[model samples]
Target chain A: MSVSELSLDRDPSSRFVPWIVAALSLMCAIALGTAFALASMTADWGRAASDQVTLRVATGDTDIPALVDQVARLEAVSRIEHLPREQVARMLQPWLGDVAQVDTALLPLPALIDVRLKPGADTSELRALIADRSEITLDSADAWLAPLQDLAGLARLVAWVLAAVAVGAIMLVTVFATRSALVNQRQTVDLLRLIGAADGYIAKRFQRHGLRLALFGGIAGTVPGLIVIFFATAAARLQGAALLNGLTPSLAGWLAIAALPLIVALVATFTARVTVLKLLRASW
Target chain B: MQQQGTDGTGEPLVAMRNVGLRYGTGPEVLRDLDLELAEGSFHFLTGRSGAGKSSLLSLLHLSRRPSRGLMRVFGHDMQDMPAREVPVLRRRIGVVFQDFRLLDHLSAQENVALPLKVANSMDSDRIDEIVQELIEWVGLSQQAQARPPTLSGGEKQRVAIARAVISSPRLLLADEPTGNVDQEMGERLMRLFVKLNSLGTTIVIATHDLSLPGRYGYPLLHLEDGRLSNESGGAA
Candidate 1:
């Protein structure tokens, strides 16, 4: 009989391969999703920081309107806003608590000015303009956000590495499973060979079996990951956390997750074919 | 018209010169064998239980390579043949094992249809039709759908025999093919083999039933302690 009809699907080792593959797929999907989300968030934060700078002017002896007009007049500066004293205190409420509000005269506060720079604007002119004003210090968003951005970039790299490891794990597990299946189905393989079955015909049956299991497992694993991502994204959105907005995967990210099953199936099929052909040859 | 047994090269279907076989550092089971089977030739291989009849059949089936000899089948040197070409060569040879190696998962019909399936020479409908007819001929119509595990010894033997002949292979080797069946069934199975032989299939039956060789009037190649002898008791 054709090796396809040899009841290989009922083999004991075969029963566990799909579940193992599914577990690996789930881990892979989640890792990839995390990487994608981190990338999205990093891009958003980098864009916001790259085009903005903040100026903190000491309260005493500073002409805020004249400074704003001077900064706005710079050719590279797109817009500038001088924050009122009360708003600066409000921004520090999380750190200073109600003390800043208890009495404005109790502490010396700086006047905050937010500045937006045009794309490709050089910061040297702005820095030079503020250099002579000892009380006015220019703080570029990029300078303050560099450490946080580095941490996010490292996290994204780790997630990508984890996803790649998951794929490698799937391949290794498939190899073991295929080898176990061959051991279990030794009698059937010998029978097929005795009956004049070509090695390709026998290997094809195993390849098809491996592909089927991998596809089923991949889809099963991806579905749960998608569910988790959906709910996690929803929760992040509900909480209105600006930094957490990047937790949602983009369209391309979703498409990659969707393609995971096919990728894993191809891997499994090729592995099974090579393993079976090599083992069959060894038997001869 | 029946096709010639040889592949138009006038070579015997099989030629073994000084062939010997052993299992993993053990004493040789078959020793210094030199034999040839001409195109469309029929012979009975008679030997005791340990006379290496199965070993010889396995060698012919390409299941094992001769340890030190020049063995050729269908005009190809088996020792030098590529691994991939083994299956193509095997398709032209059919063997019925002594133990009736029918796959327990497949039904009798599927077992009988195996050769055709592996050869892929016939479509499913034709395979089914032919398998059914062969099952009926072997008196297994009632057990066509029965798995090998559930079938009786004689029934399983019949299924094996049917499988061996289904592909109409150029060389047919049977190791005690009728050992499980009664005299009536054995005679019936012999008729089937004779019919196939008449149609240009080379046949070899290894059996302890010494009466068969004389009754069938075929040449007898007797084995005695890993050696072959051409007996004069049968037709030459």
Candidate 2:
């Protein structure tokens, strides 16, 4: 056996320490991965919403060109494209199936116009310009997607909270394991101390043990965690749902998840070192 | 037969002036221990079974801080020694407990090699050779791989002795150093201790068997009722 291992007697609880760290690492990886994904998705959605607006013009006796001309004059309105009636009809195909077979004259579809805006464009001026035109409704995509943005923000917060909780739990597990080892190897510790072993020297042995086990557990837990995330993202993609399009983790998110095991190992090692040092100092 | 002095050297290796120790609120286990073990001196601490020989040694070993009075080991005042400095102080003083206190999980050779490993003394390659030499000297070459549970009492004592002297500590405190060994083995261990002392290591052996010290003719520090009852004989 190595001299570090020889410093303390083997504790039965030591067998469970790595497994506990692994489980915690799994939780941490998933939580952090989710938070990172949500943050990335929200950022993209926010950018898109801020740069675009939509308008619905009524088809009943409304001067569409005059209304378009007025909106186009606004400083914020960079570009405006009036969506064709055929395209609008296609957009409603899922809700009103095969509207193409109906008479075009009988269809009461409103003219849809997509408006692109400059960055940081003021929307209140656009709202005031269309205030009197009841037939022309203005819709800022940012305002429309605000609730979803809030929900995503809340979810990101929850995931971050979960990751923090998992890290705290790993630290607590390390503390408990170190303490148990200390108790089990009390005689050996006494012998070492009596024979002039430095407290740091003794604590280092326990720290190295904890670090090795935590690293193993971290890898064990992280592999499965990443696998779960991978499969979940793939399944979402297979479903081809618009809502699930941005659920996959971003590059940074994947990196964070990949680093989870090492983080756990470091945290466990630090906690064990501090615990041993504190107890040893308290004893004297 | 009463005496109190160093070996005529400046700043003795270990010094205690009216030292006292107690557990919790109980009565003192050691009291009024005015003594010194100077450089390269060899001494025997003798007392009755409950006369605090082990307790006195514990003070020198830096295991317990004195409840009252001054105690110094390796020039650091025990009463004011910082917590961080205790281990550094202890590293210079080797101790052998009365109970052997060998880690059962470690092999005999590992137990014997503890001090060097603990002190991080010498290079790794030199460590193996030195440890092997010490183990063979203790006549445990065949039992080097054996764990403490498998070793006999005398064998464990030898391992403990080897561990105590591995680092060549400036001061060695042994409690019942030869309690479990035969006379022949005991004599052999004594010679090892004597050899260590001749190399400038101060030695203190606490034993109820007075004949060991009588034979060696080392200075004797006798204890009675938690006090140093007498000190006599030897060059010190």
User: Which predicted model would earn the best TM-score?
Assistant: 2
lDDT of 2 by residue, B131-156 (tens): 89988887899998999999887888
Runs of candidate 2 with Cα error greater than 4 angstroms are A5-9, A60-63, A66-79, A89-109, A118-135, B1-9, B136-151, B230-236
Question: Taking the tens digit of each residue's C-alpha lDDT, what string does model 1 give over A1-284?
Answer: 34355677888888888888899899888888888777777787777777888999986988889989989999999988988778877877878888544686666999889999998787888999988889988887677678978998898889889889988888887788888988988877887898799999888888998999999999999889878777876787678877676667888988888899999999999999998999999866
Q: Which candidate has the top score in lDDT?
A: 1
Alpha-carbon lDDT of model 1: 0.84
| Model 2, residue B184: C-alpha shift (Å) | 2.0
Off by over 4 Å in 1: A1-4, A57-77, A94-111, A119-136, A236-241, B1-8, B136-139, B229-236
Model 1 residue A270 distance off true place after TM-score fit, in angstroms:
2.7
True interface contacts reproduced by each model, as a fraction?
0.63, 0.67
What C-alpha lDDT do the candidate models reach, one value each? 0.84, 0.83
Q: Which candidate wins on DockQ?
A: 2
**Between which residue pairs do clashes occur in model 2?**
none
Error of 2 at A269 (Å): 0.5
